[model samples]
Target: MINSHQALSDTVISNGYCVGCGACAVPEQSPFKILMDSYGQYRAHMDDSPVFGRTDSSYEELCPFSSSAPNEDDIAKQYYAETCEHHPQAGYYKGVYVGHVAEDEFRTRGSSGGMGTWVLHELLDKKRVDYVIHVRSETADKDLNNIPFKYQVSRTLDEVRLGGKSRYYPIELSQVLKTVRDQPGRYAVVGVPCFIKSVRLLQAQDPILAERIKYCVGLVCGHLKSAHYAESLAWQMGIPPSELEAIDFRIKDPSQPANRYSTYAKGPSGEKVVPTNNLFGADWGAGTFKYKACDFCDDVFAETADVVLGDAWLPEYVQDSDGTNVVITRNSDIQLLIENARNDGRLALDDLSIEKAVQSQDAGLRHRKISIGYRLHCEKEANAWVPTKRTKPSRTLNPRHEMKRQRLRTELRDLSHKSFLVAKKTGDLSVYTTAMTPVYNRYLIQKRSFLRRTYFLVKKTLKAMIGR
Candidate 1:
């Protein structure tokens, strides 16, 4: 038997299922606070002082990992309603596009395209929202390498533009949402999928959040990484983790394809730039520094958001190092704004079919939607409490890819925790490199094996024969 009193702490925080969305700490007098743990990830900490024999169940309601939290479909249906069409991969949407801002300098600076920044600029310039809540790098005169990024409320177009580019660092909304609650004003917030969902959940409970937050923009996410991800990459660039002052995860390289970007780090020793692929543990698939909660989440396209933006990873846009964005517009007003921009020659956009939109993030969809079931099963086998998910758990996988998928799921689940701990304890990234190399090598072997390729070809042949 389990006590319902400690449910949020026991099931989420203790089990490493907390995604650091900061919902539990939103209430002014809440007992929980968000803090960085030893492993460089944000986690909720409960007050040690005992005040009562009973627990407040409200925290569980806002927690995405709790069974009480509504799944992505339910949230979308409640918000989007009949105005959007739903797909298993891309979720609900009114329109889809592959585009970039017409400005060359802005286009080159963004992680993918300048669409996200452009949207914020429009919201502020048109006075649609009084404030733009987004993540920006932390800068201080003391040390460049140790500055932590944060979510800020930008009040001007220049401030919003200064916050452009993708921030892969961990950020939570509790403090900023409290600001929104105290100082009432129309606001627009941008975040990754889970964080956006958390904001939606908070709005449902508090009328202040509901009234203040006028727009929700979502970024397509493969997974969230801890602070160690930056440290690890910086260490590989000849700057120790402690000496890092600032880091930019996405820098366009003219000689490389759009998919290939470089990371720039500023340290006490000046600055260093390195291609992402050359860095150890740069493989996003291995999930070296990923948050555990990401594995159980299935909302790849941010179903509940007003609009979602992601890298346009299709063949047509891969040749452009400046990059392009794949966007899905769910709100009529935002759709009109984008259409107007295209018509006025301020934005370059082309129609993107929903099928092609799904194809754009095929691997992410497969891992988040399909492989999730297997990961959940693994959790069950270990008797770990798993969050309720829209995607159900199953042992079934395509026979052709079963081995590869299984290997990846196991390695990612284990490595995410292990590598972070090793890096934190020893302060040496080589420990992570030495440990993950063999595991990743094995994953590569399974993926490229002759037998696996033969199995896939045979399966295709059989499917064709059966169709004929």
Candidate 2:
């Protein structure tokens, strides 16, 4: 809440909770830049350049954290059911959930097999979309040398490939929406669950957006982390943030026997690669600078997006891991594209049941469910669920994983108590304090356990080899 900064070219805010997910800080000449303030939290600073389009409050509306519209559950559900019934596609939705891995080079390079970008490329290549309104990164000039990358979109896959997974800090989708409105063409977009939801909500409110956007791709997100996540990672790798050249949060080891995962950064001297498990525990999933809006979000399955994609971090996936993406396609059109791709040998996939899909998500959470289902309840009633706080946990943890669930439940409860104490002491009881408590707590506990297990397994395997 830095009042000194006012909205001019684009409405920007100092959401101390920003995780530098690069949703805002895209390279594509946005009116705003994601920068770290004195408090160490990342906030969007309006780029004073003349090229930033006419200043408007519209960007504020696209923000997932502070928006004017009620979270429309009925529409989300109706869309979900309708997509499944009449136009079901393979690897689309898991039950009512919508998400899938994209079939392209991006799948191997992205955070989770590059599915989000895959969808964008397909939409463009198949002529189903004239433009793909997804974010891409650009290098900063010496004037903004402190910043490494910025985000913008391009119609061609070549331009989109330039941005790759280098996150642009503080991106605003309203700018892209405005672009779509002006250009007047069908486009596909990739965004976090809430950002995609915002598009659906915006389309409902603004007829122009409704007519413009053709498809939505969602990333399976637990929470969005802050710039500190990047800072800390760079520090750990001995690459000062300013010296960093190229970075990718999730990098599939193309040369590894099994795309053994790594988080990579390129500095002036060379590259640094750290096991993906090492990065998962501390910040990306749950830590300081966690986006406040994500706590209240219950769309882990991305019910709003036409497709969702994430890493299939299960025991079976380790065999060939150059990158095995777990995709859930919610839109039939996108599904048809996938089926066609696989048939034509562009991609390969195995049939996954809905039960398996849920398991993939819960394995990371140790099989417990969070109760943000006011949306689901509202959908059943065919009404809008005003985005607000509710205390109940709706989704049940997988019953078969009861032992694991209990361990996670105990850890989460302890974390919740600690977070509550912090919130009460600060007296800043933002909705995230209540809404995200379960998700944040459960994620931390489960991820920690997963890492520990992976570590021991690696250690034991090495020991056995030595003994032999």
Using lDDT as the measure, the top candidate is 1
- List model 1 lDDT by residue over 1-468, tens digit each: 443326788888888899888988996567788998877778888886765644465778788777778888888888787888878788888989998999545686678888988898898888899999988755522332235888888898877877778767788888999999999799999988888889888888889999999999999999888888888889889888788789888889999988899989988788899999998777777676788889888988888889999998899888899889999999988888889989998889999999998888988898889888887877887888888898777766665366455657567556756775786578877777777788887777776674668788899999999999
Model 2, C-alpha of 65: deviation from truth (Å):
4.7
Candidate 1 residue pairs in backbone clash = 144-245, 144-246, 145-244, 145-245
lDDT of 2: 0.54
Write down the lDDT of every candidate, Cα atoms only.
Answer: 0.82, 0.54
Model 2, 42-124: lDDT tens digits are 45676655663443434444444443434435446657665563221122353232223444556555554555566677788
C-alpha RMSD (angstroms) for model 2: 10.7
C-alpha lDDT of residue 395 in model 1: 65
After TM-score superposition, the amount by which residue 94's alpha carbon in candidate 2 deviates from its true location, in angstroms, is 7.1
The total of clashing pairs for model 2 equals: 34
| Candidate 2 ranges beyond 4 A from true positions | 1-68, 85-107, 140-151, 166-170, 254-260, 276-288, 363-468
